[model samples]
Target: MKKIFCFLLILSLSAFGFYPSVSSASEKSQQEVKEAKQYVQKHVPILKNEFKKLSRSSSLEDIESLIEKHFKEYPAPQSLKSNKISVFDAFPEKQHKYEKFSGKSLNLNNLLNDIKTSSTGDVFTFESKDNTVKVLLGEFGDINILEQKSISNPSVSKAKTTKATGIQRQTGIGYGTYGTKLYTLWCEGNFSYNGKTVKVISKDGDYHKHPSGSILTLDPRGLGKERDASIGKYKYKEVFSRLRVEGVLGFKWGEWIYKARTVETYIGSTVDGNIYGGLKSYK
Candidate 1:
């Protein structure tokens, strides 16, 4: 009888172990969804409030000034403790292997490949204020900055029409740090135009500084139809003679929206003063 009882007990325990754990999993999933919703509600409001203020900007400079004032949320992760850049920022390490150049154009595939070959899992530091970006590359990965372009009122045919409007254009910002891979920022009213609406599919870009000011990099591949329709000629612009970006502005002129995508790249400079380069898009 004792032997029989022992066997029965073993069988009961095994059955209990095999029972499904669906109830607990369901509860955990619900909790995660609730937390995510709360996060969206909290951060989305700030973007909305800032956009309302930007609507009042009258000139490209005014719009840029408005964004600069309200765009205080730095894109760098807290682990890196930098405002504009982080240490562990990685770009597409190795994919493209060609070199192309124009009077002022960027080759993204090669750029990403270089980043993959370089950059270790180390942190860096960066700071930007009043048109200057200062970065401290720490003890990992070789950094090469190359082909930087800076322009004050560097007007292009693409941005000329939009510049005439004197309204602030919304731009997204990305930065990197040690513990965090990348940080992203967006303005609420920065999107939505002329009764059209859209959302970001993905982003690929880097953060850098130029002779004139701070600049963010981007990639334009896989941007959807809404954004493709907004393409227009634009010139290089320095809103307050402080911030700088490289790409075609005024891409969103017609019924479409602009959505920018970015991937990781290396952490060095080929030429001094020219930190990084990539494509730019919006949607």
Candidate 2:
């Protein structure tokens, strides 16, 4: 009877012993899981709301408001020990502002037509003929090209500036929504007019060097045999006396980019030595 009582007491103690410890452990585990779920439930809405706001905002203000709202509701997780959000979190509006000038906004074809009919075309001649043998800028879009007949133009202008100066000479054209970084369009072709020959020059891509002095890269569609060849090379050249046109263009500035749409042509050069090439209508 004593042995049986001792055995029964041991069995009862063992069962109860596990019951208290396991119940306590299970309660703590459940609490932890509940807290985690609560944290996720709170923060998920914040992230979702911000993402939606970002998608709709054309300007940066809306995005910023959403970010501030999120922070108020979902403080950083405490388990992280140290919580720091990125500067982007501090100024979410800046994202849109930063992206404002990051892509092309003008229709190349339309802008070309706007410029061609807008001017008499001769107004694009380089004023600094003493330093630049030839400079031609489109008065329609951010497009320009300069050729140093002998590479000895006092201080040879940087390629982008040379191009811009030419564009600036145009009366009605201005930089499109892309803002000023760097835009280029160049081309070369052969044409015969009235028995004399002329080399037509044009450009059609963004060729601006970065602040770090790097040129922009090309996408698959932007890349062509024309881009791979040198603008200075004679291949794109055309010897047309009456008026023939050809050239390539490249553009780049910060995150903005553009390309020439209409092929370039030189007009009114029956005299042969006079240079004439400018952006024209697509049709």
Candidate with best lDDT = 2
Which TM-score value belongs to model 1? 0.21
Weakest ten-residue segment in model 2 by summed lDDT? 4-13
| Residue lDDT tens for model 2, 1-283 | 0000000000000000001121233333444434433554455444544444443212223333544465456543332111122112222333344334433332222222333543311111222232221211221111222321111111213542221111111111112111122223332222222223322233222222223112223221231112221144222222111111111222221122222222222212221223233333221
Per-residue error (Å), model 2, residue 163: 27
lDDT of 1 by residue, 1-283 (tens): 0000000000000000011122333343444334333433343344344434443313333433433443245222222132121111221111121111112222223222333443211111111211111111112111111111122221123633321211121222222111121222211111111113222222222233322212223322321111222224421211110112232211110111112222222111111111122222222
- Clashes, model 2: 42
